[model samples]
Target: MSVGKRAEPDPYSLPVPGLVRRVRRIAGISQRELARAARISHGVIGRIEKGTSMPTLPVLERILGVAGLGIVVVNDEGRVIRPMLDRADAHDGADRRYPSHLDTILDPEPGEWWGDIYGLARPPETFHRDRSRRDMQRRRSQWEVRVARHRHEPPPPKVPDYY
Candidate 1:
């Protein structure tokens, strides 16, 4: 155990074995060499690459550091956005606020009402609008039924019958 290590480790959201293999190949190092560099057993590296075992965050960081590559945070569209702040930085300092344009480019704000200069609120070629329309249309019949029922229903008696 290291000086400051969590007893229970967090699981990875993304596939890391693939990434380890990719970076290891890019670094042009064998599993054994990578293990040596990261100070972990070669078997551990193999298991990590084979997806049999998961490394702790520190171990993964060490392995990635040795491969001359690091992890990146990405948006929903698979575009790399920014690296996470270090643990120390996470505790202190003002949030790194990006400009509006960068937000538009990297991660657009949700529910942005207006269309852009391109005259499209969203890209026309995307299937999202089509899917949304289909979903709404599918539910439209049910909504229309409710609306019709409300319209046809007689108004409550001017004098309440129960009262």
Candidate 2:
């Protein structure tokens, strides 16, 4: 064996490629069949499995959905984690999510919220979001935090408080 070379890194890592292939395998369908069922081009499915290209979230969801497989967010314990609901009137008049960093003030006193122009009829909530505080942590970092929590380990270094 040649000992002077490092292993080739997987082009797509474990998530997308493995997910696409595994879903099709479990559903007992060929890539062509999956593409037909998902109404996507067969080349796209092949590219995904070959790690030559990455599919957008919607595209992957469509393929998985066609295979009767749905993506679920889960923790280290493998239990399905429900996403945060927008039930507390989290959306504005445009039905867009407000910034998550700032506190959401529910049942606000008039000046407590800036969404008055949206003409909400006594909205159940409002966000006093500060635009400057963009706490947009990457998904990888957030997943690391969840893994730490599941392992009963201390959280990794806190993202600096920008305030």
Candidate 3:
């Protein structure tokens, strides 16, 4: 029996060196930091950024993961190439929105894969998130206090006892 070999990815569809750099910038991390986080050598990261080296699939995934990103394959028509699994059933209400696919033939990355939601593609800064959460909690507690106070009031003075 003979087995078929899997086809290699098209060179044209692979992400460009600049895409990695841009994502790293957006992630607000230095090249060394990304290397440290991904547990890869900084020299490898530098070469990858410089277009002097091409990262293997695993290396690319590791770097992207550290930047809070992932890769996806898309057809020429810009449609995603993944299997259509029922997102609702799979995630059980854990965020069912899909990422937007941009048509940028000139871009190094042929397809865009957004794992995060609109307006929240990148994780927010920790301090900012903490502040916002505390404000929301305070507002909620205030609302609850008002509700409790109203519930315990003296029934509006018994409606004047004559009207």
Candidate 4:
């Protein structure tokens, strides 16, 4: 071995081959057995275990499911990360799933959307660019703090030029 320091595996992640082998060992089943139960070709399990092929998420989940196991996402602190549920009647113009990174607004009011302005069939549930969204958030925070400081103050007098 070279004198360079060996890389250590991340505790949070499992390589596909290792994961497949570990799961099979835990279930005390042979590759053929797992393939039969998971309804995949027998060669698939062998390939996965041998690191020649990687299983898709659904296929992996199916194999694990039949073995009485499940795949769960976890953070560094080992807390479970649950998937967000889609709101009822809250779909974009194309009726597909909303982008997960942005907050989804339901039942948008008139003039609350860009799609209406352009009369596009697939007008968004529009998402703002990251910079625009951040700037808006910053402005909102500043406005909120200003309003909070003068919560009980009366409205300022109108400009003299307007009289």
TM-scores of all candidate predictions against the true structure: 0.41, 0.51, 0.43, 0.54
Pairs of colliding residues, candidate 4:
none
Q: What is the lDDT of residue 85 in candidate 1?
A: 42
Each model's lDDT: 0.60, 0.71, 0.58, 0.68
Model 1, 41-158: lDDT tens digits are: 9999998888889898899899989867766776659998974444322221255432322112223333331344346655211112233333444355455567766576544323
Ranking by TM-score: 4, 2, 3, 1
Worst ten in a row by lDDT for model 1: 98-107
lDDT tens string, model 3, 1-163? 1345879977546555887797688789998898898889999989888877888888888888876888887877999899655433222123533332211111112112232324334321111123333344545555566887666543322211111
lDDT of 2 by residue, 31-73 (tens): 9999998889999999998888998878888988976888787
By the lDDT metric, which is better: model 2 or model 3? 2
**Top-lDDT structure, candidate number:** 2
Tell me the lDDT of model 4 at 53.
76
lDDT of model 3 at position 81:
97
Candidate 3: segments with Cα more than 4 A from true spot: 1-13, 83-163
Shift in Å, residue 109, candidate 1: 29
Candidate 2, pairs of clashing residues: none
lDDT comparing candidate 3 with the true structure: 0.58
Query: Which pairs, if any, clash in model 3?
Result: none
**For candidate 2, what is the lDDT?**
0.71
